[model samples]
Target chain A: MSTTATAIDNKKGLWRGGVSPFKASYGKLMMWFFLLSDAFTFSTLLVTYAFIRWSAPAYKGEASDFVFSTEYWPIPEKVYEAFPGFHGVELPLVFVGLMTFILIMSSVTMVLAVEAGHRMDRKSVVKWMLWTIIGGIAFLGCQAWEWTHFINGTEAGTIGDVVKNGLWINNYEIHGANLTFNQYGPPAFAALFFFITGFHGFHVFSGVVINVIIFFNSATGMYERRGHYEMIEKVGLYWHFVDLVWVFVFTFFYLI
Target chain B: MEQVSNVVVQPADRKKIWGIWKVALILFIVTSIEYVFAFTMSKGMLLNVIFVTLTIVKATYIVSEFMHLGHEIKSLMYSIILPMLFIVWLIVSLVNIEGAAIKGARGTQDFTGSNGATEQVDEGH
Candidate 1:
């Protein structure tokens, strides 16, 4: 009779109040809390980007004049304008568009994985997570290509002769035989770009690692034994956060 | 134990998937509009307002639907968004301060024919 009463009490406790389907273990809850804090960190960085862009001195010259391949602060589109096999043509924002699509598709795959988890379909979960990881790798590859293009000036002309206006004019030269303020608008721009993107990329890399581990576990039926796929759901939250951050990056860093 | 079984047995309406898809479609449409506006419109005061508005709309959908913040308790919602208000306040104040500093520097440069050091020395020891 005592055991029956205890069982009844446990049952009553389960739904006495509103309960969340996502109420998992403590580790999962803590992960959500940590992600909330991390979200604030990224927001601070992006807000700082807005502040700096607003505070910078505006030059009357055209954006192409003072951007990449010159001694001026890079115009984002010019710096990231790579499109394979269409060499020597200045097509703006093509690569960024591709990167955005990759990220969105990865996000779609992540949702599919989460849906599979809800259905307790381990095979589907693993399959979709693999696709999501592939999407992440593709994005990282695109970023690497972008970084390379940025470091090595395009064939428009040699590096030092480029001016603030995307023109490869002959007169402009890096003072003191090295590129400095005269070539780039300010050192802060490049420094911030590398730091922010590098930090975000690091997050993506870590996310992929976590996803792979989860995939392996699911494939081995570890989660099935545990009777839930909450781990996948927790990781999905992290993946979505990464995608959210990239949307901001696309808008602020690329389009703006 | 009984209530746990009941909760598990309660079938979630599969129609919720359609609602999720609707939210996603709205987000995509808004983002596409933002892209179009950005590419076609010249940068100016009006464009800035429009872009910021559209961005907020997209952010709203992501936060509410994708993040599931809408399903959360009202207090939790306030806790998250209230801090963001403070961030917005800080951004506004800092931008104003920086703007003032730049204006002051430019004024000194225009009047003194130098970057303000001579004026400082003349007024000081």
Candidate 2:
């Protein structure tokens, strides 16, 4: 009877309140919840983008029909062709691919940093954190270049087509994209581009900031003083979340 | 996790390094395949299916592996992931209804107009 009671007590303790899934702490669980909420927001935006893209007409009017002729949508390949130096050549999807690769590499470094943190190795954590920050900076630089190119746009429309008011009249004058006008096909395309990428870029910017802070803390041996490097792992969760979002964004915007 | 007097910090999980590398490798390979499809496949049902499937695969892998959710208690994992099915349902139904509305509008709306076309609203005017 004593042994049975002890066994019941142990089981109660183990299953108390509820099984803590994976023994995850409150912070990690909350992080998952936060990520889940953010997922919904992102998915809505992307799904709407698809809905708009699918419903909208590809080419608005005919080239021969001068009065009605205006192309509203630019093909993804055509818009994203030129690389930074090779502006003259049409190299589609290459630059975005590079950006994606950089982000992925950063994620790898972050994982390594976390791995090092698990071992309580401060030097390895700092090194990996520094590399991860550099990768983040590089990705942001590439995005800046991309945004500039997108805003400036390329020459669009036919020869006779001219800018009437802000709208492309006979011709679609390729200009920097904004709320009102841009040269890259439809205004919605540019608008959606700005909204989606802008949001993601903001996340990256904040991630970098958090990374820098943690990097400084790790350098100063803050986690070491606490006898644990859980901070690194926490920030790591955030970093990986950022990378995961990027994966989705890359697919929605660039690839498909 | 609650702390106790005897609670000792465990050594770093060394084996996770290998797992991370494998997941990263898989993600990279899948992305490469996506690029291949982008250049080769014309836009169609098959292309869409491939993109969605690969994207889901990549996402699930990232969530499970990188986030370490897969190692978590089964109930916790289920609690988190099961709700996402509703999100998928929401997206599908909304897109379907909205798409049907817009595609139907194509019949009534004359897109070949010379006026400055804004969004759908400006198009009509």
Q: Highest lDDT among the candidates is held by which one?
A: 2
By how many angstroms RMSD does model 2 differ from the true structure? 6.2
Interface RMSD of 2: 4.9
Q: Model 1 - which docking category?
A: incorrect
Best by TM-score: 2
Candidate 2 CAPRI-style tier: acceptable
lDDT of 1 by residue, A63-159 (tens): 5344333222345555566687777876778777788778777877777777777777776788989998999999998887776565554444333
The C-alpha stretches of model 2 lying farther than 4 A from their native spots are A1-22, A59-72, A155-172, B1-15, B106-123
Q: For every model shown, what is its TM-score relative to the native structure? A: 0.76, 0.83
Instruction: Output the lDDT of residue A231, model 2.
Output: 78
Give the lDDT of residue A122 in candidate 2: 77
In model 2, the Cα lDDT at residue A5 comes to 63
